[model samples]
Target: MAKVGRIKLGSQGLEVSAQGLGCRDLSGPGKPEPDMIALVRHAIDIGVTFLDTSDFYGHNANEVFLGKALKEDEVREKVELASKFGVSFADGGNKVDIRGDPEYVRAACEASLKRLDVDCIDVYYQHRVDTRVPIEVTIGELKKLVEEGKIKYIGLSEASPSTIRRAHAIHPITAVQVEWSLWSRDVEEEIVPTCRELGIGIVAYCPLGRGFFSSGAKVAERFSENDPRKRLPRFQPENLEQNNTIFERVSEMAKRKGCTSSQLALAWLHHQGSDVCPIPGTTKIENLNQNIGALSVKLSPQELLGLESFVAADSVKGDRSAIGLATWKESDTPQLSSWVAA
Candidate 1:
């Protein structure tokens, strides 16, 4: 197997693996701790040192699990750890709340530090833009965290171009995580350009179209009763049936390229630019290895365009997520003065 390569995440000098491990699924109930630790260790062993997690995932259980995974000597130092704040659960994990007030920012960082058992987080992100709080105010608190050595870099997820600019003006945003896949090309128009202009890295989450390219239409059939994708519009029987046509087109191209549909999908993102890194999450070791193999599936400029043609943004049916309000298009905060007045 080939080793995972490295990349400079942003102008801020934060370097990490070309491919990152999304550690969200490694936590939560019924997931064996020992196996999860082994999965993380395996990724580290193979040079995939960038790990992503969120405080909202499993309601903080993910960070605690990561702390244990990196507890051994030298393990933490070898990893470029990125965890997020801002989103919290209420009403028995049924109600989702986004928060970016200064107090919540500080408290969330302190809590994440404790759970991760780390003195400094490599990269900390405002998982969602809390429209109630001004972007400047939220970023101001994050700037203080950077100065205090609590977090080395800052990131934003699902942030609009204006929000990104405002946040960057307050502090350099090291990265912006968004849904960018073969079927999710909406970010290419404005968000991608803005990040490039501001020297921010793009962390492409769900780069495999949330496993659609990997398993095709059958993916919907495999979803468990409690699977969140069940609620997503794209995965609904009618929409999924329509979306399967797009997958079929990509799968046919992947076979000609001598790679799986998943590899081809990820390879397209890899060809996007050196500044873009895809963090596709998987619980199985085989899937982890497969994701890493994407680094080797090179695509020429023509092949890149060919793949894009197969799954154009309009070609895919349904919204990216069930909650449309959480995407970058809707991720703008109120003015700082308005927030202050309130």
Candidate 2:
């Protein structure tokens, strides 16, 4: 078993495993609940101590399941737990609603605490920016929570540079979670630099390009009707054919490096900087072990460039999401005075 190493996230005193385990899609339809619980325990047993989850996943079932998983055998005490709020589903899961009002923030945190059955969350994040509310108001309430010992640290996800600045001004943002992978490099332009400038950590979700870098194009063929990837533009048949070429080139490079494509993709993020942590989620123990192997697969500066050339950010086909889901580029919020006047 490979023992995962620990690193500091942000300038805060918080420290976690070099690579965290994203806790999503583990409690949804067609998923084995018992197996998922076992996977969480197995990950903690192996030193993958940073666990990430969201309230919107499975319509709140993910957090409830995590509560059950952590209660068994004193599992909760062994890891740094993180979860998100501010995003919810409406219209039978067809419409996405984002809320960041002070009232919503406090109520959401209390709900999450009950679901996780924990007294204090290690890190709490606003999952999506609510454009209607001022970032200051949201952070102000979060600051109150910190002082009250409800959450130890604050974080933001899919926030614009301006929104991040405003929120961080009110309270220290320990981390910013975003879609950062070989195929998703847009964050590097602004979000990454802003986080670095503020001494914040970057928690990279979908670090393997939603499993494309790991399983290649064949992974798309396995998507069931319920799978949300089927609706993503990148997975459409037309775009997928073009994107497969990038995967082929990356596959060749991975072979040359004597590592799997997934390991190579993760290793590239590991080389970005010490402040970046990639949380690649997996339901299978075998894949979990394989992802951990990425830690040992070192990459030289020249090799890193070679991998980037194979999948340059712009060369990849299609948007990160279908559209209108409150991504960072569209994450600016209303001004505090404007909201007050309204």
Candidate 3:
């Protein structure tokens, strides 16, 4: 395949591979350590330098594995590392925590620094919106880190536009990471336009619908019960039964485009706007290559519009997130929901 496309993340002018690598899969998601290392290095060898991970991945295995790989390859400068905080590992697994106070922010950055084995974080993001904590306070703390040169840039994940605005006002928030794809266009109505207006990049996690759109039903079934997707609304059996129509549309479009379903889904996303970037995770080198190849998969104007309309409210099946997590606020002002308490 040709080289992957590259784009500027937010306004920092840091260029990363258009099709970034989701490093979360490297920590025993399915593959072993040796295999995972090979997959990661191979991905970078093929020009995927934007490696995305989070502190909560594999109970902290993601950062550790990435650090080992980066040190082994001696390509710290060659790769752009994007990692997140906010989820605590004190009790095992991911539990939402909104400790964005100045002290917590400094400690988190320092902890991520040690785990990543890097002096500076290429991009540091708050893993989630802490409704209990004002975003300005959280971002103001991040701004201190930026000024102190602890992190090169700041980002937010799954934050509403108002939260984004509140945080950005304190500091130039670089990107917003959300689980956006053909299956989840809810971000289009507000997040997309707002990010574009603010010059913030949109990093799309689960760009393949957490493997729902790309992998066949049989493969999805292979995911361990502990997999986060297993608990998500769309992945539930009943919900999936009703959601297969989305894949049918994908399969049909893939045939016409002469690409895999994953490629079709990713191509459609890239068409959404230049400001959007999707980091689809995988533990296989071949799959990594296939995902990056999506940059070459072209879609017609009619195809784009058709895909959008196809995912309209009537066509979409179940809640994008669990009922509680689905309570999305889409602006730059403070908004509260009953779900935040859940």
Candidate 2 residue pairs in clash (backbone atoms < 3 Å): none
Error of 3 at 342 (Å): 22
Model 2 off-target regions past 4 Å? 91-94
Off by over 4 Å in 3: 90-96, 326-342
Regions more than 4 Å wrong, model 1:
91-94
Q: Across residues 1-342, which tens digit of lDDT does each residue of candidate 1 receive?
A: 768999998899999999999999998777899998999999999999999998988889899999999999789999999999999887988888999989889999999999999999999999999988889999999999999999999999999999999999999999999999988889999999999999999999999888899988899888889999898989988798889998888889889988899998888888899999899999989999988888888888888878778776677888888965588888898987677633
* Model 3 weakest 10-residue run by lDDT: 333-342
Checking candidate 1 for backbone clashes, the offending pairs are none
**TM-scores for candidates 1 onward, in order:** 0.97, 0.97, 0.92
lDDT of 3 at 337: 30
TM-score, prediction 2: 0.97
lDDT (10s digit) by residue, model 3, range 94-118: 4555555557777878888999899
Count of backbone collisions in candidate 1: 0
